[model samples]
Target chain A: MNVAKHMLFPDVGEGIREGTLVKWLVKEGDPVKEDQPIAEVETDKAVVEIPSRDHGTVLKLYGKPGDVILVGKPLMTVGEPGEPMPDAEEAITESNEKKVEVPKKEASAAPERILAPPSVRAAARKAGIDLSKVSGSGPGGRITAEDLEKAKGGALAAPASTHQEKTLSFDYGKGKRVPLTHLRKTISERMSWSWRHVAHVTYIEEVDFGALKELRGRNKPKAEQMGFKLTPLAYMVKAVATTLKQYPRFNASLDEEKAELILHDEINVAVGVDTEEGLIAPVLKNADQKSVFDIAKEIGGLSEKARARKLSLDELRASTFTVTNIGSVGGVLATAVLNPPESAILGVNRMKDRPVVRDGKIVIRPMTYLGLTFDHRVGDGADAARFMKDLVEKLENPAWMEKG
Target chain B: MSRKKVFEAQIEYLQILDEKGNVDASLDPKLDELTLKKMYETMVRSRAMDKKAISLQRQGRCYTYVPTEGQEAAQVGSVMASKKEDWMVPAFRENAAYLAKGVSMRTLFLYWMGHEEGSRFEKDQNCFPVSIPVGSQVGHAVGLAWAAKIQGKRQAAITFFGDGASSEGDFHESANFAGVFQIPCVFICQNNQYAISTPRARQTRSETIAQKAIAYGFEGIQVDGNDVLAMYVATKKALEKGYAGKGPTLIEAITYRIAAHTTSDDPKRYRDEAEVEAWRKKDPIARFQTYLKKNGFWNEAYEKEVQEKAAREVEEAVKKAEGFQANPEDMFKYLYQDLTPDLRQQMQEMKQSLEG
Candidate 1:
C-alpha cells in the first residue's frame, strides 16, 4: 500500500530559520519508523530532535550533523516494508530526504544509492584502498566501513584494545569560555569589539583627599541618621553630576551630524552593583535635579534593591553618566568600559590614607584614585579634567549643593 | 540582605503624588494647568471606557477586554507624541494609545464588537489590529520600522505591551532586531508591576526592562508613565532620535495597574487592597488635574462637559457596533487572498449542511 518517497524537513513552530544537523540516528539500508529520531537540529534556543515523517527502509543518508540544513530539505528516504524501486528521478526529490547508518555493513544491499553522507568518500576513494581487501573493524566487519585512521605502508592492523577516554584540557597561553548568561555573553562581545576597534585613551589621576574627607565627615552622620549613608560613594555621585554640568563637554556625546559636541541637559547616572552572576548597573534617572539627601537615599536604595534583587525593568535603564566602585573592593585603579552609547564612565578605587598638603600643611589624609574612560570618538582630555575639577570641588564641599 | 537596595531610577520608581490630589514636584515634573487637566480628562475617559468594555464582556457583547483603569497616562504618554505615520502596535491593554493615536472611538469599539472592518483604518492612521498574543506585535512594529529604514522613511513605530509580555521570546526578538537595525521603533513596555497574577519581582533577575534595549545596541529608558508630561517629553525625544534613523528606543513606562488585569481576572486574589491604595495616591490623572485646575486651564464645568461628551460617544459606538449585521460566513473568509479549491469545496459543503 506504499509508494516511494523521501521525507523532507518541515519548518516547525519554533521559528528556527536554519539549523545545524548535530547527528543522524540512521545510516544507509536501516529500517526506520515513522516517528523515529532521524536527526538533531540545533537552533538559537536549544537542540531539537526531529523525527521521521514516514516508515520505510533508509535508502541513503543525505546529510550529517554539523552540516547546515535549510528548512524543507530532503532528510531521509522511505518505502514499503517489501517494495519494488520507483524511478530514481521521481522517487528521491532534490528537495527530498534519506536516512541510515550501517558501519561495516555491506553498501551493496541497495543497488539504487545516489548520494553518500559526506563528500569525504571521494577523498577516501582517491587513497586506493580496495573495499574487499581490508578487514573491517566496523559493525558486522563487512568491509563496508571506511576509516579516518588507516595503515600507510602495508602494515597489517591488529584488533584494537578498547578503553573509553574523554579529556578537557587547557594551555597556559590559551583560554576557553563557556557562556555564563546571555547578557554577559553580549557584554563580553561588545566590550571586546570596542577594545579592538575603538581607540581608547586612559587618563587616570590620584587626588588629594584632605579637604573632601573633612566635607564628607561633616555630612556623613547627618545623612546616616536620615536613613541615608553618606559614604564616599554618595560624595562621588554628587561630584560626577556637578562636574558634568560645569564641563558640558564631558557630558557631551558624539553628535556626528552637526559635526560638533552635543551636550545633554540632564545628568542621569548609573551605578554598578556586584551580583552573584556578574555585574548589573541600574540608573538614577535625573541625578542633577536631586538634592544630597535624595541622591544619597536613592543610591543606597538602588544598590540595596539590586542586591536583594527587587529591581523592575524600568530601574535598569536611563543613564547619561555612570560610576563603577571597584574602589570598594580595594582596587586603586582600573579602566572601566564606556558602557557604549554613553560617552564616558568614571571608575573609583578604595579610599586609603595617604600624605597630602591641605591649606599649606602636609598630613596623612584618606585619598582614592580615579580612572575616567571616555569615548574620544566624542570627548577630549580638557573636557574630562574639567569634569574632574568640578567633581573634586563638590566632594570637598557638600554645602555647595544648596547654592543652586 | 535586608532588602538594602531598590532600583530607584528617577523615571520608573517614585511615589510623590498622593491620591487626595497632592504632589511633591521636587521628585517629579510639575504638571502645568492645561496639560494636567487634559491628563485627568484622558484618565477619566479611559476609566469609563474600561468599565464599559467590562460590561460589554459581561453581557457577551465582546470576546474579551483588557482594562486600563489606573494606567491611563502610561498607555497615553507612551505613544502620545508619535507622528501620524508612525505605527502604534497594542497588546490589548492600550485603549489609551488608540484614543491618543486618533483611531476613532467608533473603530476601536467596532473591533471589540467583532467587526474585522474595525482594523481597516485610514492610511494616515498607522495602527495594527489589537494583538491577543502577548509581545508578538512588538516584533511586528520593529519590522515595520525596519522596513521604513530600508525605504528611508522618517517614521518610527511605537509598540505597547504589559509587564507580562516582557517574558516572551518575541519581546527579546523585537528588541534585538530594533537594536541591530537601529530602526525607528519605540518599545513602550508598561511595567504595571504584574503579568496576570504574577508580580513584577518574579519576572527575571534583569536590572530593568529598558536595559534590555542596551543589549541590542541603543538606549533603554524608564519613564514615569503616570506622569503624563514626563512620558510625553521623553517619548518625544526618543521618537525624534529614532525617526532621524538613530536606532530603536526602549521606553519602559513604570506605573500601577489600579484595577484587576481584566474584568475576567480578580486582582484581589493576587494583590492586596493596601498596595493598590498606596499606588492610587500617586494617580497620574488626579495629580495632573490638580495642577490644571490650580492653573485655570479647567474647572468642574469643563470636566463635566468632556466627561459627558466622551461617555455619549462611547455609548453610541457600542449601540452602532451591536446593530451592525455580522455575516456568519465571515469567519470562513479571509483565510487566504482567495479561497483554494479545497476550501471552496468545504464552504460549498457547509452551505448545504446549513440549508438542510
Candidate 2:
C-alpha cells in the first residue's frame, strides 16, 4: 500500500496567526512532485511558499490562494487513482482529532504494552515510577498523569495519593489547555530567546542635574511661546541622539547566521509610549537632523495618536534604536534587557536634585540616573562604558548643540 | 504599640516658627544645628529657584513653572528627611522638594523649558521622577519601594503630592501597597490651601488627610508645613522609622500655595487679595530668615550675602540655560528602548510628508 499525502502547515515567520493564499504554484489535478512549491502564503512578517511532501495526483483542493490555512493542518489531499487507498490513517493526521481504532483486542492478549513516545517512558523511569501497572487516563486508556500517580502508590498501599496527584495529574483537569496564538507564541519565544542569546549587562550611573535644570529653564518659556510644551522628554531625546552619533555602533544589531554586525546608517529612534491598547514604540526617523521643536511637535502628535490607538502597524516597526523613560512619575534608575534586534536600550529614571560634589563644592544639582542594557554579541564592557560616558557627557552639557 | 504608635505617627504636623527659629529642647535634639542650617538653606534655595522659574516664565524664556514660593518650608523640611538612597517621588508642584533633593537648577530650568531630555535624571540617585500628571507618582513610589523591599534595599521612598492628589486612585493604591507590604514609604501630602482653585473643604470629607493613613494600616500625621524644623524632624523620624521596618508613613504637611498655580493660572481669579495677604504674612523663607536672625545662627550680613549669592546663582543659571541650544527635538526622542515595526513606517511617511 502506498501512503497518501496532503500538505501539512509550514512555519511562517513573524506573528502571523493564519497565512493568506497569495497564489497557487500547482493547480487542481496537477501531478505534483515531492518537495514541490505548492502555494505562496502571505503572513504578517513575510510571504513564504508551502512545499508538498509526496508525489501524487491532486485528488482534491481544500482551499484556494485567497484563503488562509493554519499551520499543522491539511491544505490538500493527493493519492494514486489506480487503487483504492489503503487505510493510510497517517495521511489525515492533521485533520484527525479522534481515536484511530485498531478495533478488536486480540482474543489471546499479549500483556498490555505501552505504545507511547520514548520521552514519556524515560520520564516515568526517571521518577522511578512504572507505567506498566497503572491504567492510563489518556484517550483509550493511554498512560498519562493519572496512570503515573497510581503507579507511584498502589491504592492499597499509601494515603499520599491526594497530595501526590500533582505529579500524576496530567489531565487538563476541568480546565482547558488552549493552543497559543502566533503573536503570543512569538512573544514568548522571543523573550526567552533574548534571555538565552544575549548576555544582558546592566550598568547604572547617576548624573548631576544642575545643568539640566538651567538648560530646561532658559528654554521653557520660548518653547511655550513657540506653541510647544518643552518637556524633559525632549531634552532626553536630544541627549540620546547626541550620544548615538558619538557611539554609532550601539545602534547596530547582529545577524545570527551571518555572524556579522549589521550597523544601520540611519538613526530611527523609537520611544516606548503607553497607549490605551498597550505599550507601543513610535519611531522618530532621522532624529539627528530634526530640531527639538520638530521633535516636540512630532512627540505631541504621536503621543496623541498613540493614546488614541490610531498608530499603523508600520509606525511600530521601524526602530533601529530605542529609549524607554519610566521617569515620568519619578522612577529611580531601572534595568532593562535588550529589545530584540536592537543592540541596546537606555532606561531613564526620575529627576532629583541631590547633594553632589560639583567643582569640589557640595551643591544641590538636579540629577537623572540611567541604566543601559546591550547585547554582548555586538558589544563588550568597554563599548558599553564608552557609550554610557558619551550619553552622560551630552546630558551634562545642555549647550551641546552650540559646540556641535 | 499599635495605638500609641498610631498616635505618635499623627504628631508630625508643623506650622509656627520657633521664637529664635530653633526647635524646643525636645525637638531641637532631633535636629542638630548643621541640619537646621541645611534645612534653612534648602528652603531659601527652593524659594529662590521658584522665584527664578516664575520670572523666567514671565521673561518668555521657560514654560509654565510651578512656584513653591510660599510652601518652601513644607517641601524642604519633609523631603530632606529622606536618606540619599531613599526615593522621593514628586508631583509637579513639589518644586521646593525637587531642589531639596538636589536636582540642579539647570535641570529644573530645562524641565520648565519643556525639554524631555531635562527630565532624564542621574542613574544612581534613588528618586522617582517629576510627573506632570497629578497624583500618578504616589502609586509608582509604592511600587518602586516595594521592589526595594523585595530586593532588601531597606531604602524607603517618600512621594510628594498636593492635596489635589488625594483624589487620584494612585493615592489609594500606593497607600494600600505601602501598608500591605509594610514597605518603607512616606506619602508626603503638601496640603497647600488649594488644588488649583478647589479649596480643602471641597476636596475631601476626611478631617485630616494624615488620618487616612489608618485605613491603610500605617502611621499618619499632620505636620506644620510652614515650620521648617517641624517638617524636618517629622520627615526624618518617618524615614528612620520606615527604614527600621516599622512601616510606611503618610504625612500631611499643611502649607499654603502663595504663588499662582503656575505661570499660566491667575490666582486673582479664584483666590482673594485678603487670602494672599494673610498667606504672605506666613512666608516660609522670611519666617525662617527672621527666626535665624533672632538667634545667633544668622545675622544681617549672612542674610544679605546668602540672598545676594542666591540671586546671582539664579541669574547665572538663567544665562547658561538660555545659552544652551534650544534643540526642541528632545521632546520626541526618548520613548521606548526600541521601536516596533509600525513606528518605522509612520516616521518614514512623516518625513516624506514633511519634506514633500
Candidate 3:
C-alpha cells in the first residue's frame, strides 16, 4: 500500500499569502532524493527554491510556471511512482485542508450600498449603524445627516431633535491622476491598518548629540578602515537594541486575540531606506549580537540593496523593531506609524545648534529630538516615555557604545 | 628559442540587414515569407505591449516596469530560433522573449501588477520567471542544461542576460560550469549600453563582451542586435551547435536601451537626448518593417490590422489583470514548504489583527 502525501506552499515569510511557481526542478514520475530542491517559487520579496523533505517519486505536480499557488493549497503530491492517487474529494478533505478551514468564520454579509452624501455617511459610520437597514426621507430618497441622527436616536430610544447640522461641499480642480505602485499601496494599507488596530501614543524627548558627534569623529577613521562610515544612526540602533532588553514590552508584538505579548529574543532592527519606488524597511538581523561598526556596515549594504530593489525576502521580514532617521532628510521631528507585528518605532530627528544651560551658563550644543511611537495596547504612556528616556540617556552619554 | 602562439579567438560579427534596411541576399537565412512576417508581427506586438505597460505605469496601474523598446529584434529573433521544448532563462527585461514563448499578455500584466499568479506558468512551459537579481539566472540555466545532459535529453537551454550581468560573478561561474560540463546551453547577452546610469564601457574594460567567453573555453560571436535577420541566423546556428553537443556558446547582441532602466529611472539624468535620437534612426521595429515591405509581406492595410489586433489583445490583458482581487495575505503564503515556529507565530498574529 502506497500513501501519497500532499505538499502545500509553506508560509515562508511573515504574513505571505501566495507564491508563483518559478520552476519545477523535478518532473512528474521522476525519483527524487531527500533534501533535493524540488521546485523554485517566487514570493513577493525573493525567489525561494523549496527542498523535498522526504525521498519519494514525483507523484503529481499541481501548477505550471507563472501560476500563483495559494498558501495551504496543494503544490504537489509525493508517493510511489505510477501509484494510483486518491480521488479529488478525498484530497480536499485531508487534514491540511481542514486546518485551513478551521479559522474561517462565516463572513458577515457586506452592508448594502446606500446613496448618501459625505456627511451622512460619516454620521452613519460614527453611529455604528448598518446603513442598508436605514430608510431615507430626503430628496430623491437620499439619506441625509438628519436621517442618520434620527435612526441613531430611534435605536437608542432617545428623543429626536429638530437641530440640523450644515454640510459643506467644495469644488476641487481636476489634476493628473497617479495610480499607486505596489509599495505605495502596501504603505497606505499598512498605515491605515496600524491606526485602526493599535492605539498609538508618541513620546518625544530631546537628546544632546554632542557626545555622539565626538565619538563618531573619533571612530570615523577606524570605521572607514573597516569598510563602513560611522553615523549617529548606527549608535542609536545600538542604544535602542540595548534599551529593549530592559523594557521588553517595547520590543514585543501584541496578539490581541490571545492577549499575549511576543518578546523576541533577537534584536532585529529595521532601518527605513528611501528609494525611487517608495520607503522600504530592510532588516539588520541579530543587531543585539553585532557591534556598532558591524551594524554600520550592514546598514550601508542593506540600504544600497534596498534602494536597488535587490533586497531578499529574509531582509524584508521578521523585523522585531524599526528605526527611521528623518534626520537624514533634514526633518526636525516626525511621529512614524508603527510597522505592525512590531509594537514600537523609533524616529531620529536632525541635530541642530541650540543654546543650552551648561553649569548655569548658556552654551551652544547639538540637540536633536527622538520620538518613540508605541502601541498603547502593549504598554502605557508612562512606559513608552521611560523607553525614550532610557534611549536618550544612553545617547547623551557615549559609555554604552564603547562597552557593548 | 621563441614560443609559438597556441591559440587566438576570432570574434565574427553577423549582420544580414544593415541600418538602412538593405539585406545582403547572400547572408540571408532565407526564412519562408510567412515566418518572416510572423516574426515582424511579433516584434510589433511586443512593442505594442511594452507601450501599453509604460502607459499603465504612468497611470499608476502597474508597478515599476522595464521596457524592451529598442532591442525587440535581439529578444524576438533569439527566442524564435529555439524549439518549443527548449528551456528559456530570462532576465527581467525579456518582454519580447516571453511573448515569443507564448506567455499570455495577461500574465505579463499581472506580473507588473505585483500578483503572484502572474508569474505562475502552465506545466508545459519551459520558461523561468523573470530573474530580477541580475545574471543570477545564468547559473540556473547551466544547471538545467546539465540535468538534461545527465538525463540524456536532447533539449538545449538558452539564457538571456545583459552587459551589466556579464560583470557579475554568477555569469562567469555559469560560463565556467557550462564549459566544464560541456552542457547544451546558449548564453545570449543583450549589450544594451547601460545598466541604470552606468554605461556598458564602464561595466567591463574588455573590448567586447563576447570576448569574455573565450576565457571560459567557448566560442563567442557578435551581431547587430537591431538586425533581426542577423540575430535569427546567429541564434539558429548557436542552437544547432548546442544540440550537436558542441558545448555552450555566448552571443553578444549589440543593442541600445532606448527606454529608461525602468519606470522608476530617469534616463535624462545621465544620458543625452541627442544620443537617443541617433539610436531612433536605427530602431529595430522600423528597420524590420522596411525589410517586410521590401519583401512584399507588409502593406499599409496589413500593418494597420496588426497594430489594431495588438492593441486589442493588450487592452484585454489589462482588463484581465485588473480583474484579479489581490489578497495582501498572499504575500505570506508559499514562502516555505512548512511554516517555522516563528512564521507560525507571525501568521497567528496576522490572522488576529485581520479578524479585528
Cα lDDT of all candidates, in order? 0.70, 0.72, 0.83
Worst 10 residues of 2 chain A by lDDT: A98-107
Ranking by DockQ: 1, 3, 2
For candidate 1, write residues A1-404 as lDDT tens digits: 56667665554322334566666878777888755677765544234456665567887666664456656556666776456544446544543422322322334564433233233345446665543445555433433323423431243344431221234686757475333443355568867766755556667777666666677677777777777787667667777876777666656566567777667787888888897546778788778777767777887888887765456546776677788898776666788877755778888877898878868999887787888888777767877776676666666555675321
Give the docking tier of candidate 1: incorrect
B1-356 in candidate 3: lDDT tens per residue? 99999898789899989888889999988899988987888889889998777755533356788899999999889989989888989999998998888899999899988888878777778899989999999999999888988888888999999999999999999999899888899999999999888988789889899998899999999999988888889998888888888889999999998987886665765777788999999999888888888988889999999999998998799889989887656666667888778878767766775565
Q: What is the TM-score of chain B in candidate 1?
A: 0.87
List DockQ for all candidates: 0.02, 0.00, 0.01
User: B33-96, model 2: which lDDT tens digit per residue?
Assistant: 6776787777777777876665444323566677777788878887777778888788887767
* TM-score ranking of the models: 3, 2, 1
Q: Evaluate model 1: give its lDDT.
A: 0.70
**Which tens-of-lDDT digit does each residue in A1-404 have in candidate 2?**
76555555543432234666656788778998755777766555344455665578876666664465665456667787663543335545644543333324432465667754577677778777666766677745678654665676664366766555353546566774444433345557767788878888877888776776777778778878878787777677767876788776788888989888888887878887875334667888778777776777777777777665445455566577878887887667678766678888888888887888868899887788888888877788898888888778777776864321
Give the clash total for candidate 3: 22
lDDT head-to-head 2 vs 3, winner: 3
**Candidate with maximal DockQ:** 1
